[model samples]
Target chain A: MTSARSNNTRLLTVFTILSVLFMIGWWQETDVSIVRADESDIGFRVNPVIPTNQEEKNASWFRLNLKSGDTQPLQMNVTNTLKKDITMKCVPTVAVTNPIGQVLYNQMTPKRDDTLQMDFTKIGPRPFTFKIPAGKTMVVTQVIKVPKTNFNGAVFGGFVFYSNDVNAAHQQSASSSKRGVSMFNQYQIVVATVLNINKAAEVTPDLRIDRVTPMAYRGNPAVTAQFHNTKPAVIEGQQMSFNARVYYRGGKKVLFRNVTNQMNFAPNSTIDYVISWGNTRMQPGNYTLRTKVTTGGAGPSWNLVKNFTITGNQADKLNKGTKRADYSWLIIFLIIAGLMLVAILIAWVYRAGKRSSVKNAGH
Target chain B: MKKSWSTALSVAALALVAAPVFGNVASVQAAGPKSGDAALSGVGYANTNGASGWPAAGVEPQTASGTSVAGIGFVAGDLTLNQVPVFDFGVHNIGSSETFSMQPVDSAFRPQKLSGNPITADTKANAGVRALVVTDSRAQMTQTAGYQVILQFSPLQSAKVNDSGQFLDAKGSATTDPTKFTYNTGTDNKPVTMSGASLQFSSASVNPSTDWNAFIGDSLDFGDKAAIYPAIYTNSGKSGPVPAGSMYTTQTRLAAKDAPAAVGTSIDEGKAQVIYRANMKTGFGTWAYDFTAPSSVTMKIPSANQQTGTWVSQLTWVLVDDPTQDHANPIISQLEQ
Candidate 1:
């Protein structure tokens, strides 16, 4: 009984001590991906979210189609596979480069934690140099500023991953010699920006005239033409000077009559161009005014014309064509007496045409 | 055995009188109701259903048979066993626009929890994130665009206990608004104007990205690598010398020969000027944290020797011969020691 009791006490004591030690070790460790003195998680956490694009290989960098107008700070996961206590900085950068080390855009990037700004350049293996702690993982992230160009395709940049897994790094590192650290083993994240983008060429603009009705007022004629620019972009995007000329049918060839006017076409705009056969530009006569507008480089020429006849002698414009007398009285007197004669003539014509065909058949 | 017997007897009596406490209470709950009848078979029979309930918070039971599957949440072994501490964060394309929002995986950093922490939402906190910039390539026109986001985080910095005896520097509460999000419209709002950020919400205007997901970052110091900086789309109908409004609007790099001069300096090469202010009262030197994992408390190794030299974002290392030997060279010291 004594022996059994002592054995029980010793077993319980050893077990209790072991339990306490386990608890202490658990409580004291700071495994960055797995845990810490207070936190047990410290090493790599390959987030359960599956890789979306085919370019997303094992331990490769990727481009998130994350576009935001807001400039707020953001945090992302540096998802890993290892479950060791580790702490790493998650940093973000917009590549001014491609995977093959071609410098696409070179800008000075600012450091996330410090006041330092990183100027991008070609290093040995990685695209950019970043710091990762021993036994800790680093998360690369940044608050994507809303870019001016909202792109439709994927961005081609290099996501250079670096680790202190090299022998030199391990030998030089002073932090946590006991925590078996995997000297920095790194590979560049050849992030193939897979994007589903849609784009369309802008619509071609053409001028359509609503109406070119020619009208006469006080023995003077004028032609009005409506013009419009139906495009999304501003038509007057470039500074353009303009001029136009008017022409008329002078017997055979068309004649030019300059319209003293200058105007602009706003992008997708509609405006009216009016040309008059008034005394200043033309005399009171039967004439056609053809208007021609010239715009700056590469623009199609505009040619439009309308004809109007002046009537009555109101002196504003002389009716150059033969003027008609007041013939309403003569026409009215004749129509009063012609109803019977018209009926007899119609009967005769019908009989005569039938007789001619019959005579030809008999012959 | 006597002590355990007395404790079990005491627990048995307490079961009749009061609540359970101390020494594997979960096990006691798992042991099931007493196998005897109370009140001489007149009182209530054994309450076998008690074992079917959920374990109390922070309690651990060895077996799962007694508890219902629905009642038991998966328990994790502590972090000491290389189970949960290693953390890695990155910007991954979770398919497309269908996914992307602020979500922190750790229990401590969930968006809702960060929103409630006592924080100093200052320029330093803002430094952790960068604005998106124009990423359109050279073409007659940059149509159909997309942006590249770079995430950064440096090692943590230890804040000294302040005058009030509180280890306070900057703490903050974070809230996210996924709306007010847009891409390159080629108008007043430009993506190129918003890349490589170092400051977070020191301003009331800064908001999270539209297609943002949860990322890990420091609550106090913005790592030279920690900020969540967004960038311009590939090509969305706008290019030809990144619009003057881009964040890298003015990007001029020092030549290879001139790079050494920029080793310890923070210079501005872009028009979006960012200023960094020191919090020290008296004269102070510029300071950066040593990114490293701490050792166990054996008390045998010297603390000065426990530093991991600084590397540029897990890439290049600018290390000393020995972290423990700050100024002393071991080669030279062998002659003197």
Candidate 2:
């Protein structure tokens, strides 16, 4: 009896320890090294053309300083280790700020912006194409002839190289027609070339708040303010501070109060800055969100106010049917506890029967 | 007896509970799909009958017994293209046949040091071999072997000129016409005739110094004197000068036919470059070719065939999978590996 009881206790103890360890494992985050099965074997590299006296080695991009109307000759030393020969088509493209707040230079067909006076297609080299022998290096040249008239600030553009093998690349981009089994991995890389025209120019940078959006960011409710730099000059050393408040229809009761500061902007770029609200339950109601932004110590400032209404149906849609998994540990623990209760009940019944049998033997 | 029964029941219960605590949690979801791939559908059960009664979100006892078949497929790996050289051959004396070297040069056509091209070639004795980089990751999977890479070049074709019927000259000056430039669109039977000036191609020795053996680590075999095969493909028995639109293949030492690459090993067969000399006829028009000519091969051009304005042609390089008979099964056999 004693040995059996001790065995049960030991078994229960080991199981309890195991359950705890399993729970901890489930709770902790795991980092798994996932190797992509669809990654392409084709690769290419763009090496910056550094002049004889320059110090940058194997730099990823190029920065050129030139006077207006000054013609500069630029060359890219390209190497192709691909097994097949490639007809590399080169085009000059302009960089613009995307909605996601990052600078994009690889837009195939970019819309013309009035603020960007210097045209990339005009000053850049004619579209050049050359064959790179497999495992051979070929040099492609582009001569940028700045307009004769003097201009200020910078002209942002990039020389884009593309592999004209659409058929082969397309084959690698899609897998067998099976429904769940699809794989694609052909991507293009762009080298950003920033041409800083002349050394010095005096210009004013314009800042404007483009839009404000309410959405979930990183699993938290937040408001993102999208802003843009309209001028060709880069906005440097500028500081921004804003106060955001939400009030009821008549501006009587305040519901949300947020204050943000020290937001900076890139040159000719747009950024979406998010301010998070921690798990605040929002109800359908009229609200007023007002913000005031100040730039630099004594430079400039802007005020923005917007009145909006949140519909009940929209709030219901945003919060209504979202579902999350229950904690695995909690469910497992409850199941274990219920099993333990049944085991205890069984033991009690067994003990009671044993006592009754012993008493009957005494009679 | 009663105590033993109770203890046995408790132990059985515990055993039953512990079975699924660690069954297959490691394979919960196959992570998210990468960009440009298939989007994620609704949640899938690793071991469940989805067709009969799919498990809803937060549904208990969601698993069912079924054989899951995860399929594996092939995609071309990302290869690196680095250090492409700009071939800017300046003006040529119309009557004289000028030979240009495909070596890295400054704006003045003088040899210069590039990122990948070292300075030892300045003396023209150890001239820097122009090379491109191609990295393959297909062999990364356990079932895959190395791939066979192939390269082909298109003939020099006509490019667009400005509306004024003028194109940029070598110095970016608008002093040329697109109509004046014509390539040697010759066949094996009917090669272009040059009266006085002729275009020529000269083959420079393949650079054997590149560290091709080290890129693939121990994954690939280059032993037994296996060597890269560099040749210009032509219908004329690959003889004389390589006609326009011919293919030039640089020799790459492959895995020895005797041995196969082990499974799950990726190999990079280092750099391979084919260098050639270009001797032109009717000197004004620019022509591009990978023509791996013999040391002193020349094609003559008659002055009557020459036009005054500058004419430019383009060279196109294309890298594709080697479709040769020997490489039909470029991947080493899995069983052999």
TM of each candidate vs. truth = 0.18, 0.36
- Per-residue CA lDDT of model 1 for B176-221, tens digit only, reads 1111112122355432221111112121111133221122223222
What TM-score does chain B of candidate 2 reach? 0.31
Per-residue CA lDDT of model 2 for A1-363, tens digit only, reads 999999999999999999999887643312111112121224444443544333333233555677778877665555454667666666677765432222445545556664567766678555666665564444455777888766776676666666656324433332221211111223344555666676434666676666666654323344566666777665333244455566676766656666544343435666554444444544567666666667657866777666666676655444422224225578899999999999999999999999999999999
Compared with the true structure, what per-residue lDDT tens digits does model 1 show for residues A199-259? 2123233444444545332223444455444332222212222232344445645443323
DockQ result, candidate 2: 0.01
Top lDDT hit = 2
TM-score of each model's B chain? 0.14, 0.31
Candidate No. with top TM-score:
2
RMSD of each: 34.4, 38.2
